[model samples]
Target: MSGGILSPLDRAIVRATQEGLPLVERPYHAVAEAVGTTPEEVMARMERLLAAGVIRRIGLVPNHYALGYGFNGMTVWDVADEDIAEAGLLVGNLDFVSHCYHRPRHLPHWPYSLFAMIHAKEKAAADALVASIAQLLGPLSRGHLVLFSSRILKKTGLRL
Candidate 1:
């Protein structure tokens, strides 16, 4: 939809921001120069795009590993369906959980309905966080597991 409706300047803005905003005081100014527009105009265009749901997110994505968070575990749980919504909100609000959401379950093989990502500086810390989450879920959880990430993958440019 955006591809067809966006002006050339807007398209350039999308390309320029595909990776991320420049790490500078006036990132929008830099973007304006790249797209041949004024900073205020760029900001206005961005606001319009966001209002139109063309841009979904604009925020800092912290580098946990760089900040001494060495262990990353994607904790998945098989929670009671009726209780998943409440449990997910609880887990998602936890200080130690970076991401928490509900996903579909593939029964007979993979049955995890709740997914939460826990990060820590060490394996023990990550494990402790997982334990806390398990305890929090208690009887509402059917089963759970941790899928540890062994390596960090660089974030490349736009997917499409």
Candidate 2:
């Protein structure tokens, strides 16, 4: 693992996977070719990287909207800094929540510190998920807002 000190080859492997694994019968072989390594070595290195905690997951990222999860809302909250970790863990565990993370507040005008994205087939379902998050946070949340997305302008995850 080298204590997360990635070698040049390790960095190359990470970079190759960033754009996402290639769609092929042997994706690892493709990655190996791109990184100038053998497929077995690539798989072993990836396993080590995973055990080292440098990589959290490697899997498909589906477009839920295409699968009838049309309503997506970003629920933002102004939570006490001390309680955010606990509250965020609870919110992130909800089945409807797709993503959750902490972000810096913009102060006076924009004060949300934690954000959670919920996806559902309808607006009412998304609203119910927001309500569940509100109940979980309870007094820990000073204020919260749910902004339902009207459309998907861009779908790809940012690579740079």
Candidate 3:
């Protein structure tokens, strides 16, 4: 049995796939070949890593821009602290909301705590999505701001 530290092979696997899995039918096999191992071995090791919580998850990161979703809005809400959990769950389940989570509130200048990300082809569509979230939150939402993204940010998973 091994300790908590990652093995060399495990590190190799993480490094190879950290950027992203290959865009192919058999991505794991490609990763295995790159890391000098069999696909089965690579899959088994990845499973172990997931079970141990060494890696949170493995999933595709799509480019919304390429998909014609140019309007990206990060909507921040001033949700009641006690009702944040329920509010977050409700907002997060919406089809338009990509992600929703709680954040620490800064009093006075910045009172918003809950945040949800959304994307659409037009600004109006993005606003409508935000309004739906607001309607869902109801009185639990004190106020909110839909901060549209001005530029694309580098998106990457954890590094080895």
Evaluated with lDDT, which candidate comes out highest?
3
| Per-residue lDDT over 1-160 for candidate 1, one digit per residue giving the tens place of the 0 to 100 score | 2654988788899899878999899999999999899999989988888888888777778878898888999999999889999999989999989889999999899999999999999999989999999899898888999999888788564543
* Model 3 per-residue lDDT tens digits across residues 83-144: 99999989989888888889999888899999999999998898888888889999999999
Clashes of 2: 0
TM-score, cand. 3: 0.94
Ordering by TM-score: 3, 1, 2
Worst 10 residues of 3 by lDDT: 151-160
Best TM-score among the predictions, by candidate number: 3
Q: For every model shown, what is its TM-score relative to the native structure? A: 0.89, 0.75, 0.94
Q: Could you tell me the TM-score of candidate 2?
A: 0.75
Off by over 4 Å in 1: 1-4, 156-160
Model 3, residue 50: displacement in angstroms? 1.6
Candidate 2 lDDT, 1-160, residue by residue in tens: 5765898888899899977899999999999999999999999988988788777777788777788988888999999889889988988898778899999899899899999998889888888888889998889999999988887776555352
Task: Supply the global lDDT for candidate 1.
Answer: 0.89
